[model samples]
Target: MKQSRLMSLVESVANVIVGYGVAVVTQILIFPVFGLHTTLAQNLKMGAIFTIVSIARSFALRRVFEAIRMRSAK
Candidate 1:
């Protein structure tokens, strides 16, 4: 079964949304241990930037793999 492009995008977005929350929380907890202090707003902003990049990377990789799968099915 092949996955549609829309589905791939939706999956990527959902995955990133979960990941973004995790990343922000982890940063809040872990940054102090590493002597890296940032405000909540800063953490949220950083997480948002990384989340955008992650979404793009995830979607691109999914597409690449889907293409490979389709090719090999021939």
Candidate 2:
């Protein structure tokens, strides 16, 4: 079955929300290993920025793949 645009967006957002948390936590753990230190607020801000970009990329890719699936189905 084909996925609706709204569902695609919802899925992307949900995925990114989980990823945002993971990214922040990972930064907290991993940054020190590389000698990169940042405050909690800074990490959160960076995570938010990356989350927005990730959401956009995920949604766009989903749409592109859906389009391809639709074309191939015809």
Candidate 3:
């Protein structure tokens, strides 16, 4: 149980890191080529939005997995 909890924490942290990485990479590397202006404030707002979306997606995926597992058990 403890190991599982630790793994879950690691997964959550990894998601956050990946989310930030995507935000940074897109804003820094891709946006300019597309003629998009991403200032510091815009980056912060985008980061917050992406973080929320990522966490919600993780929870939604976890719930779907749990439901599938329960159905399989029966």
Candidate 4:
């Protein structure tokens, strides 16, 4: 049970980080279509800020759901 919980936590974190990477990559690739040009550094900096926000939001929501699940399990 403990191992499963830990494994899930690790997976959740990994998934969030990977999702952030994908989002950033997609944003960089598609931005030019809109005539929004930025240097690589600028794009990366923007991506980093949004990624951190996403990770925090994801983790917080995940914990809230887990708490509610555990509560109902009893």
- Better model by lDDT, 1 or 3? 1
Model 4 shows how many backbone clashes?
A: 0
- Per-residue lDDT tens digits for candidate 3, residues 42-70, read 88788878887887677667666766776
- lDDT digits (tens) for residues 29-72 of candidate 2: 99999999999999999999999999999999999999999999
Q: After TM-score superposition, what is the CA distance of residue 1 in candidate 2 from its true location, in Å?
A: 2.1
TM-score of each: 0.98, 0.97, 0.70, 0.76
Q: In angstroms, how far off is 26's CA in candidate 3?
A: 2.0
The TM-score-based order of candidates, best leading, equals 1, 2, 4, 3
Q: In lDDT terms, how accurate is model 2?
A: 0.99
Q: For residues 1-74, could you state the per-residue lDDT of candidate 4 as single tens digits?
A: 22355655676678877876787788889999999888878887887788777767766777777778888878
- Model 2 residue 6 CA deviation (Å) reads 1.0
Candidate 2 deviates by what RMSD?
0.6
Model 1 vs. true fold: TM: 0.98
Query: On a 0 to 100 scale, what is the lDDT of residue 24 in model 2?
Result: 99
Query: Cα deviation of 74 in candidate 3 (Å)?
Result: 2.2
Q: lDDT of each model, Cα atoms only?
A: 0.99, 0.99, 0.72, 0.75
